[model samples]
Target chain A: SQTIHQWPATLVQPVGSPLSLECTVEGTSNPNLYWYRQAAGRGLQLLFYSVGIGQISSEVPQNLSASRPQDRQFILSSKKLLLSDSGFYLCAYEGADTQYFGPGTRLTVL
Target chain B: AQSVTQPDIHITVSEGASLELRCNYSYGATPYLFWYVQSPGQGLQLLLKYFSGDTLVQGIKGFEAEFKRSQSSFNLRKPSVHWSDAAEYFCAVAPSSGSARQLTFGSGTQLTVLP
Candidate 1:
């Protein structure tokens, strides 16, 4: 079974601050990875997805960007965080037609 | 484009009672269907999925979902509900044979189990 690990389970940042969240997958190689954001009382929104190293696709244009430096490592970053960016961010890896999710990161922008 | 619809935004059921959550989907062909549960401030946990073969799929935590191709629905059901089952449930669908394996999720149904 593949395991996904996301760091900084909870984050608190000020408006206009830079942001970085990391996601790493184990027991899988060259897997499809995705980033989704869920706001309060809202559905999950696809932010970005990566097929392989150095390849990233943005689903919704925003202040956030994604990078896949390694086959199993994906990073979501933003130069300046917006108050609307505050939400629960999730990382997922596709395996055997199934996308498994990580614990997720909760971001609070003040 | 594939889409999922969970009609019930919120449902309240008594503990030990039977429960059912409705889900409908739209796609060009038979898509992969999935059910996931999320607790407050937590990530989604996969409950069950249906790719092919049997239309009825069993999942973790005593949950099961039956896929009806004729009706384009995949409804989750449990014979006996527990207080721990109180959480938000989401229905999702993905293309069966596409390079883009992204899932389209519904708005979600919040389940509340009364004591």
Candidate 2:
């Protein structure tokens, strides 16, 4: 019964403001974590993935960055948010043959 | 490089009608394929996956897909569509090597069921 949790289901941030979105996994350890963004009515775009603590691979280049502080904790952060950074962010955990997604965080940069 | 392509951006069908969504992938080897459905305000739900052996695989919500190696395609099919089936569908592929779990997703297809 592995479950992934993400906080701040919805957030409104001003441009140039700092951003932080957290994700944690329960019932699973040493799991791979991923961050994805989806625009309205569009497909998901992978942003970052962490295989272990302190190790992160970024798929796209942007103001956003991801960190794995603990075995089951991942954080997506940005020092200065931009208007283009607004989207629905989804955190996912890699399973044996499938991937499980968290509830997700919707950030609106105003 | 590995990639996935879902040609149809949107599809509409009547309830109880047969449905098919086309998916194509470009990979270096016999890739692992999967289909996912996303309902409004919900996370992606795994429908099915194909690794080897059988080309055809069954999934939840009465959905199925077939892998055609020669065509480099994996198309999703359903004998009868339901009203609840109206949602976004994504086709994905994973390389056999590397993480063996990293997936490349298609742009996704929006399925609209007409009652």
Candidate 3:
């Protein structure tokens, strides 16, 4: 069975600080990876997705970026965090049609 | 562009009562529909999905949704609501596009089940 894992279940960052969130999938290769953000009481917004290593497609232009370094390792990073950037971050792997989610990371910018 | 619309922003129901949440979509052609649930501070879980064949699809957690092509709507239904079912529900549409396999999500509806 395939499983997804994300680190830093909760994070507290200062404004203008750098941020990194990691996501890795086990038992699956060549799976499509995605990074999404959910605003407070809002829907899930797609930030980036990678179909293969070194190929990242950004859905929404923001302060964050994504990179797929390995077949199952994807990372979400930010050069400088903004106050509005604080939210729940989710990493997902796509099956044939359905997408599976990770536990998600909560970042609070103070 | 293809999009999803979940009309209800919030729904409140008593435990053991019937439940129905409306979801409508705007797309040009046949599109795939999905329902997901998100608990507080947790990731979004796929509750159900509709591709073809059966109009009504059953999913985990005793949830079922019916797809109506004419109305472009996929409404989720449950025979009886439970306290555990209280969470945020999202309706998403997946257009048959390239290798991305991306999903466009709705604003979501927050369900509050009264005990």
Candidate 4:
């Protein structure tokens, strides 16, 4: 069975600090990866997605960026974080017709 | 452009009661639909999906949804709600053809199961 993993289950950072969140999928190759942010009690906003290595698509213009270094490794990064950048970050990989999500990382910017 | 609308922002039901959550979408072509559940402060979990074939699809945790083309709706239903069912439910749509399969999600419906 395939499983997805995300690091730093919870993060606290000062505004303008750099940010990096990692996501990896085991037991699957060449899978579609995505990054999404969700505000408290709000819908999810797709930030970026990658179909393959070195290929990333931005769904919305923002302070964050995503990269696919390896086939199943995806990273979400930011040179400088904003107060608005703090939210629950989710990493998902596409299956036949559905997307599976990781445990997620809760980011808090002060 | 594809968009999804989950009309009800919050729904409260008693345990063991039938539950239904409304979802509507707008797309140029046949859309790929999905339902997800998220616990408080957790990632969204895929409950079910509809790609092709049968309009009615069963998903995990005894949940099912029906895709109505004419209505442009994919509503989720459960025969008997459980206390564990209390969570935020999201309806999403994926672009049929795209380099990025990122989904467009609805605002989400918060389900509250009362005892």
Candidate 5:
């Protein structure tokens, strides 16, 4: 079975600090990866999605960006974090018709 | 652009009672619909989806949703409610023609199960 993993399950960063969140999928190759953010008491918003390595399509204009260096590894990065950047970050991969999600990372910017 | 709407922000249901949550969507063509459940501080879990064939789709955790084309609605329901079922439910939609599988989610409905 395929499984997704995300690093830094919980993070606390100061304002204007750099941010990097990593996501990796095991047991699957060339899978579509996505980054989503959910604010407190709100639904998820799609941020970035990658169909292949070095190819990323941004859904919303934001301070963050995504990169897929390997077939199974995806990274979300930010040069400088903002207070509004604090939220629950989710990593998902497309499987057949549905998408499977990772455990997620909760980042708190103070 | 595709969009989803979950009418209720929060719902309270007594244990063992029947439950129903309303969802509506708008899209240009045939749309792919999905329902996901999220526990506090947890990732969203896919409950059910509607791609084609059946209008009524059965999903995990004993949840079912019916897609009504004329009404432009896909409402989720359960025969009897359980305390464990208390969580936030989200309705999402994606365009069938697009290669991108990104989903547009609604505001979500928070379920509160009464004991």
Candidate 6:
């Protein structure tokens, strides 16, 4: 079975502060990784996805960006955070026919 | 572009009662449909999915969903509700044949199970 791990289960940051969240996958090789944001009382919005190392695709224009530094490691970063960037951040890897998610990181941008 | 629509914003069901949540999608071709459940402050757990074959698909947590192509709907149902089932439910869709495999999710429906 495959497992996805995300760091800093919860985070609190102020506007204009820099941010970085890491996601790692195990039990799989060269898997597709994705970053999604779920705003309060709203559905998820796709942020970014990576097919392989150094290959990243942005689903929507946003204040965040993603990078696949290693085959199993994906990082979401922001030079300066915004209040609108606050949300539940989810990391997912494409499984056999569907996607499996990580525990997620709850970020509060004050 | 593909999109998912979960009509209900919130629903309240009694424990042991039959439960059903509606979902609809819009796509030009065949789509891969999925339903996921999320507990508060947690990630999403797959409930079931409809890729092809049988219209009725069984999933974890005693939940099932039927795909109605004509109606462009894939509604989720459970024989009986459990208090533990209280959480937000999301419906998603992706192109059957796409390299990106990007899934577009519905707004989601918050399920509130009452005792």
Docking level of model 3? medium
lDDT at position A14, candidate 3: 99
TM-score preference between candidates 3 and 6, better one: 6
Q: DockQ winner between 4 and 5, please give it.
A: 5
Candidate 6 pairs with clashing backbones = none
Tens-place lDDT per residue, model 5, B54-78, is 8999999899999999999999999
Give the Cα error of residue A13 in candidate 6, in Å.
0.7
What's the C-alpha lDDT at position B36 in model 2?
A: 90
B-chain TM-score for every candidate: 0.98, 0.96, 0.97, 0.97, 0.97, 0.98
Chain A of candidate 1: what's the TM-score? 0.98
lDDT, residue A77, candidate 5: 96
Worst 10 contiguous positions by lDDT, candidate 1 chain B: B94-103
Per-residue lDDT tens digits of candidate 6, residues A1-110?
A: 88999998999999999999999999999998999999976679889999999999998998898999999999999999999999999999998769889999999999
Q: What is the TM-score of chain A alone in each candidate?
A: 0.98, 0.97, 0.97, 0.97, 0.98, 0.97
User: Residue by residue across B41-105, what tens digits does model 4's lDDT show?
Assistant: 78888899999899999999999999999999999999999999999999999976765567889
In candidate 1, position A109 carries an lDDT of: 99
Per-residue lDDT tens digits for candidate 5, residues A1-110, read: 89999998999999999999999999988999999999986569999999999999998898998999999999999999999999999999998868888999999999
Worst 10 residues of 3 chain A by lDDT: A37-46
Please list the residue runs of candidate 2 whose C-alpha ends up more than 4 Å from where it truly belongs after superposition.
A40-42
DockQ of candidate 3 (2 decimals): 0.79
Candidate ranking under DockQ, highest first, comes to 3, 6, 5, 4, 1, 2
For each candidate, the alpha-carbon lDDT, in order, equals 0.94, 0.91, 0.92, 0.92, 0.93, 0.93
Which consecutive 10 residues in model 5 chain A have the weakest lDDT in total?
A39-48
DockQ of each: 0.73, 0.58, 0.79, 0.75, 0.76, 0.77
Report how far residue B110 has shifted in candidate 5, in Å. 0.2
**Angstrom error at residue B97, model 1:** 1.3
Q: Model 2: per-residue lDDT, tens digit, B1-115?
A: 8889999999999999999999999988988899999988777888999989989999998999999999999999999999999999999987765662777899999999999
